[model samples]
Target chain A: MSDPMAFLLWVKGPMFNWALAIFALGTLARLLEIFLLGRRPNYAEPRGGEWGPGLRTVLTRSVADPGTFQRAPFDVLVGWIWHVGFLIALLLFIPHIELIQALIGLGWPGLPNPVVDAATAVTLVALVATLIHRLRHPVKRHLSTAEDYLIWTVTFLPLITGYLAYHRLIGPYPLALGLHILAAEIFLIVLPFTKLTHIFTAFIARWYNGAIFGRKGVQS
Target chain B: MSEPSIERGLQALRAEIDAPVAAFFSSCVHCGLCAQACPFYLETGDPKYTPVLKLEPLRRVWEREFTLWGRIKAGLGLSPKVTDALLAEWEELLYDSCTMCGRCSLVCPVGNDLQYMIRKAREGMVASGHAPEGLIGAAVRAVQTGSPMGLQWKTLEVQIRHVESSTGLTVPVDVPDVEYLVLLSSMEIINFPEYLEAIARIFDHAGVGWTLSTDCFEATNAGVQIGSKDIAATLVQRIVDAAVKLRVKNVISPECGHAYTAVRWEGPNLIGRPYPFHVYHIIEVLDALRAAGRLRTEGKETDRLSLHDPCNLARKSGVIQEQRNLMDLVAENFVDLEEHGRYQWCCGAGGGVSSNERADALRRAAFKRKKAQIEAVEPERMVTMCATCRTQLEEGLEEFNMDIPVVGLTEMLAEHLVEK
Candidate 1:
């Protein structure tokens, strides 16, 4: 058999160029979304104190409620597992690492092959579990729209294709790799357009909550 | 188990909703983030009781009976059967378990309005004659009589006279040509008369010309909370008629959260035009007084206070900051609870959940989150701007045996009011 690395190089030449173009365009689109669609100041003006104090109060108290996270153990477990798993897969994927290394000249010590493989497998299972939850649960199923299914599909494709490419499970490693890269690029393009945008906004919400409660002298 | 008249009523309401309600139900993308925001979901670990899942029956009906996609799914046998038993079960889940607190909406990524949907579902139940017997009975009495408690006009008169004698401030009733007409909920007159006393003292202190109408003084419209527009309309119409009759410049809705929203947001629309008189929630009135230097308070420097934002006032009516301002003037030791303002936690008492005996367990479960929040502050007292929330929190504290004082924002202000 021909060297898989050779095929990878050939695909990389064109795929890299396509990835860069989409990355630039997608980043630009995300920025436009932040500036245009995301600029509404949903916070109300404090009727008593200035904005500064109110803002301070919101920021401080959100962190103070460490106990809410503690009390709702199942929620915290699910939330953390899903969020952290998604972030690790998204940021440390080989192609994404390559992009980061190329753009910023930074690299982390790679995880052992077995660990990487196991994490990827676990993440895929968790994603499936979450999707099933949305389907089987009557309340969640009721609230779900068609766009929700689209997000799940878009998110799932990259992880699945990337796993297939890593294991060389398909006809050729190169083809799987190219599909994986393409899926990821498409996800980036749609990230801000869908409910996935909650990733960026959740922290802002958390911190705003912390500060508001902090100023009020309540433990977040 | 089946009453023909009630079943007929429910069928008519479900039929009347038409397409828009169905469309909204069909648009839910369940990320479960709303689950995190729901107090019931947090305490019980029961996903079935989560705010998002609570809307399933409506969603199923929309899919199977209303939407084209739903019709296709039903034709294919892909949609589950929605039997009368299923409807009965959902009646318990949707009406009895959920608190329509709107917290879920704030955290919802798509902004799926669970509260609005639940309210519509309750309206449907009321039409079907499936409403909780207590709510329906109270509403019926409210419509036939003037107040939910069935307090007679003479009793209201004595309550008014009592306020005047106790506070050395005359609370005028049925006075024509008053500049402002104040409306009090029967709960305030009977359960928390200090709220009425606070209002009279504040108005007297400010020298604002205000009169309470003995005929239509109760601000609470149980219809609004229970999702009966007809009953809500009847309650609000009385206030509107009195405002117009009294020739008042403004109508002040006391520190009742749902009452304020009903009159301010729905009152004008129900009346079919903008009301001639301005409607102000008591918090707004207090903020105005503090701003204009008319209502002065010696802040409680020693006592630590935390403010619980009521859902109706904060999310529904957009009066989030007004309560905070009132808290600041009234409490020197005020600490803002986390998730304050629009993001604040529900007191687990809104949307008529406080009145449903069957829902008490779910209500108690939901209250755990708010209690945790209160304990986090470790404040000497937790102050609120809504009367129902005050009742709910106080009741919850007693039921749960938590050490926290639940007082109205008006009550707190009255304690700190500058003596003239």
Candidate 2:
């Protein structure tokens, strides 16, 4: 419905280019980290049967136990909501769709408007709630380093900008969309550097854990 | 209930430890990723009992004393009150609930050592006379006497004689000029006598010159478990003194996990010098034997066997890989459970939590994750390297009504070893 050429120009302009450059540089830095630090494997060896069983247990226990949910209910609730919301927002954003469309020619149907809108709203609310929780909780506050706040800011900014762009509440739609894309690129670049790197490493950590316990005959 | 002298001693220790304990709490990021790795969290799903939440009391202290905001909060008397009830809750949270499994640290992106933090917190609790009565009493006895269980030298001599008769191997105690001095926990001599037989069989089988000490025989350092570094050092010092007297080249730690940490990591530091004799965990010794082709294992017929990595051996001490190497030699139907190495779950026994009756239900509940791992393999028996893990799993599995039998790797090795 918007002017396609105008949107492209804004996305390709100096502001977007600078953001893309920084984003690319940040991503490169993250990749370099793996090489620089070298791979430190978690000590446990892989148990052959562990992956399937461990996954089943993790899934079942995660749902069955309300105690874990109750212990830090607000924290867990916000954490899951933010994480799922952020992921959906990343995947279903129009620019991501365009990229996917360019690569695979739009074979799949796009996410429904209501789902995207809901995820976006939830992401914004969850992020703010998490930030507030971090500030107010004594343990969290004591533990919150400068880098932690920086990570939160970097993560939250793009989500906020993308929401604003989607709502056409910030300047023009094209400008907002371009800003959102730029913010996203920045996020991707920083993903590996910040605590966000846990995204890539969590499963690896989990699998490593499973394998070790499997070898030792302990439960993962 | 109040022993003023004990109370005074605790107050002094608490005063000494307050600052370092406070600093450790200030270091966590509170990401809650540690939840997924903790078996206790998996079992009860209690957030307050999660490894991170156990650190909250210390976190509050950190905020009050160290941080600007915390100081401001404290200045205004707006800080969360650390009531006697809160301290009591923490005693349950820190000791009863946590196994100090080190899984939380493995999953921690920041490399925050939650086990160490928990151990220190326990130590602080011990200092404040808030530790579980059983753990503190054991530590106190170990300090007063040599052994945590207070088995006299004569009882230790009788146990050694049983080992001598059963294995037909002479386990010379208090012998001078032994090249290697093997230190064992009282548990091996009392309950798990097979562990002694296994060690004696291995040492004799390897033709390695090693002897057990009559004076300082026990290796299970309850001080390490209860967070009494002084008592831990005192217990270890007896072994070190024996080693020095016997002129042993190596101090082979028995199959106890915490014993290895007490004697290996803290021993050198406590003694204020690197040990002249290198310390070797029994698994390491066995691995060396297998590696050198000095020992061979006859593969046993079994439906399936899983390995339970003890938290101290796997995570705290970095001896995870060696155990796997030994397992390969012993089990034909060995099926690995998930999260084996540094990431492995605890046996719900470490950090003296195994001795705490109040934590028993929580400990049993925490075994759900481990039980799920066992059920995955559909194994008949689960083997582990730690004696405590073996006991914990045996008790834990039974409490959960799992049919799996838990045994030590050494016991399994003794069963399957082919005489060279």
Candidate 3:
């Protein structure tokens, strides 16, 4: 019970439950708070249908428009790289797939180990570049509060720790694995409380934006 | 000062926060892409002009009242409160700089509607008596004298008489059961009486049944520009009453961008009911006439012409292609600015920036983006649908010592109309 393996077991058992509970309940409470606030009915006659544009923006906003790309190429390109890389490593890695299946009874084929490893490396690099850009760019630097830097650290830890655990470079296998799990647990706990809520709320925000402009017959 | 208070400002901000605003505030990741989209930020190189940061007070109110973490922080006196001093500092950001062009909303990576929140933020600013003096004067005059610039009915009567004498067409007033009730802005009545002549000539050429209502001819909504729903509703109600009294099937908003937005987009919502008749921008009416084969033309302008899309018309209300259709009808060599239509750069004087005299230099600075766009095309003459945009473009081009002249789209179309 006093061994490093026991520490790994404890992280996977009791600490994991606490993290999951906070993540689920906190997310639900935040979502409920938004929905309960309620929107007023628009009495203006609509020029177009809402559903089509609302659905379109949810997918289209993933890419920056040409004008936006030209103005801020670094932000747009690096942002895409990080998101794509992180999603691949999170959903396509073999162990993550097994964890998802264990939790939600959903299973899918996993990517090869090398592909996942490369994605992890790319994601780590992008995250660091993102932080440097935040510190350097005048607008980003001015707009960023303490919460932004805190969110970056929390998001960066798990990917780096997972990469180290896979390579067994930091310590023994159980000790590295336990550290990775602990980092992930901290991320999950803070997800609902901070700007990390954008994971789900982005969809809602895009739909509302699309619908409002759509009602005016514009493709926002 | 006695009329507006911090307590009322806080309440107004709390009342303005709804589901979409909640989602927008929650989704923002501070990516700063919105700053790139804003002409003011680009022109001034000021981090304070960033579009998303313009909503700081509103965001603070949203956080302090809505979120659990924010509530906890507030209880501990950790989070900043939305005070009158904070709103006073933000007055220039919200009113003097932003044109409410919605470009920030278009370019946000998280799809945050940053301009929408800024519009809401102005409500609090006004409630706290932190609004610009020029805008406050305009709003007060609009409510008290039925004209933001204090032009009375007799002033419009002089223009009507001049339009009638020149065009040799009867400019009917108070005519009931007409198909369209035409409205005008005081700017057109004072600065550009040619707009009235153009409307009379165009309507007569098409053989359309339209009349001006002496009951209410002014369409510009300074209340809307000042972000006061109560005053906006009062002004809107005057138009509604005029339209109902005339029993017109359609009402036409003049060649003013904010007036079109006020009547066509926010009119019904402000008055709390659907309009009995439809509201159309004059360009929309003109385009409809052309499409129906009613508007015949004789000749086209030979020189190179380019268009400046008004932010409220093209970006805010989707009146993009209609202007182009009208442009094609009258101009043989019409070129477009590099970025026109919904993605066009603002003339930097809409959304009450022009009304706020303190923003004169800032607005001129912001016009550098539009100037650069115009330089790329080198048009002999620039055309626009909104009167406000035309004034700004004219002044900006003159300020830069550019020889190009600005003209109204409707007046340009009227010049080429086929003789009856």
Candidate 4:
């Protein structure tokens, strides 16, 4: 734990194991609770089919509606920008894609360094703006739980630290790289325990909602 | 009834914690977007009225009773407690402010069925004796006198006689094996007698055989508004029994939105069996008749008019297109309120809000959204299918000093019917 090189090895080895285990198990348990909490079967005769609307909503609900966008334009724009940016930064970065490919056997052509760097920058700005937004808005501030802030900080740290390390802005490469991995490990451990679980649950929720509405003959 | 208490309320809430509740709680991003979609929040600028926050009691119940961390936090006094005071405070938010219009559900980014949870949350509120007095009175009258308005069979008989005289057609009562068994809301029975006359004329013109039941003609369900499925099931059972005994092929719900929901969507679920007869909103039946060439009308209205899609009819059930299709048939210059169909703004009178006096001010305030939509179009008259929406539109427009009249679509269509 004393030498910077040893810390980097620990962060990449045992620390990674612990974070990945918690991340995988915690998310699975939460997802299982939702999908398996059974109920009485619906007895009413359905007016229309469920399958079409069920999948339709899961795909369509990714964007906010116009009424929603009008009231919270900043939120809608920044939120989408950050999510899309995160995916790009995660999937299109050569290093991250190599890591994922080595583990999962899935590989795609990585975006250019400059393009990925730009996306990472936007994502970082959006994350900070969203934090400021939650602090400023009365309703959003009230709804913010401790977990919300914790998850936001943990998620922001890794991305910001990675960008800083890549450009050698925060510290020497090894020191900054160790901290980046450390922050990411924390994010992985906390992801499933917090609202970040919404990534897996959002579609399950939308499908359930849409199917019920569709069964009742309404397009949700 | 036993004096309502928090223990009973907690037990009732525990029963509603099924798969959907867990999933919705899991998926809420807490972005506060639903607050913008809510009329209670939009009109009053109150965060507590956000559809998701109104379920705080239910959410607390889910956390404390279900989740491991929630259980640990709750044991150590980390999570907020669900108390009698909380239920009392949420009663207004759950009942008075919410129309159960399902608009918030439509707008949720994660697609949380906020309206569905609000309906379940009312079970806790009612068990805690936190329901509005107006809704409670409606429930009692509905159970004891067979109509929430306390209109008796004799009253409808009088309307029946008046309709028979006006239309020169007998208003069939309790006739077995008719193609449709028409049901009326107590509001329609006591207030809009012309609805019965209009139906008589339209049915006679189309030669569509239909009958009313003396045993159970009331379609308004006070149980639904009060959020007691036990009472709702009891009322719905009466309609099922009547429909089954009469052997009617279809049950045509009157122009009452929740009545359509209670009898059509929630009825079989309440009764724990599939209905032998199909249920249709009056507009759906009218649309079918029009499609089949049974509904023949000669003339079209010449003024600019628009339609108000009742929340239950359009959003809750998929009857949106039927009303618009019917409107196209009869109105020469029909214009749509910018947000018509499933995205339509509520008249703020559905979900039992109109029955509760405590909600009157909030109802009018919420109606401003619809009122503005009307002004945007500036129609000469506003037409709607549900009688509750019709009544609320009339009252809401009057309150705002806007003179555009509200007419029931069925009556307007009857006026233009091809003469028998």
Best by lDDT: 3
lDDT of 1 by residue, B202-319 (tens): 8888878888776688788789767777788888889989888889988998888888877876666555666777888888887888889998777564688888888777766667
Q: Which 10-residue window in model 2 chain B sums to the lowest lDDT?
A: B15-24
Among these predictions, the greatest DockQ belongs to 3
- What digit string (tens of lDDT, one per residue) describes model 1 on residues A43-94? 2222233245334433442231343454344444554565566667666666
Encode model 2's per-residue lDDT on A41-97: one tens digit a residue: 222222235566445433332231343354467776787788888878777756667
Model 3 Cα shift for residue B124 (angstroms): 0.7
Indicate the docking level reached by candidate 4: medium
- What Cα-based lDDT does every candidate model obtain? 0.68, 0.68, 0.92, 0.88
Predicted complex 1: CAPRI docking category: incorrect
Quote model 1's TM-score.
0.72
RMSD of each: 8.4, 10.0, 1.2, 1.3
Please give the DockQ score of every candidate, comma-separated: 0.09, 0.06, 0.84, 0.73
Candidate 2's residue-wise lDDT over B90-137, tens digit each?
778787887776767554433344665676666556666677887877
B240-343, model 4: which lDDT tens digit per residue?
A: 89988899999999999999999898888888989999999899988898999998888899999999999898889988888888888899899999877888
Docking class of 3: high
How many residue-pair clashes does candidate 2 contain? 33
* Fnat (0 to 1) per candidate: 0.08, 0.02, 0.80, 0.67
| Candidate 1 Cα misplacement greater than 4 A, ranges | A1-159, A162-169, A172-220, B1-27, B299-301, B400-403
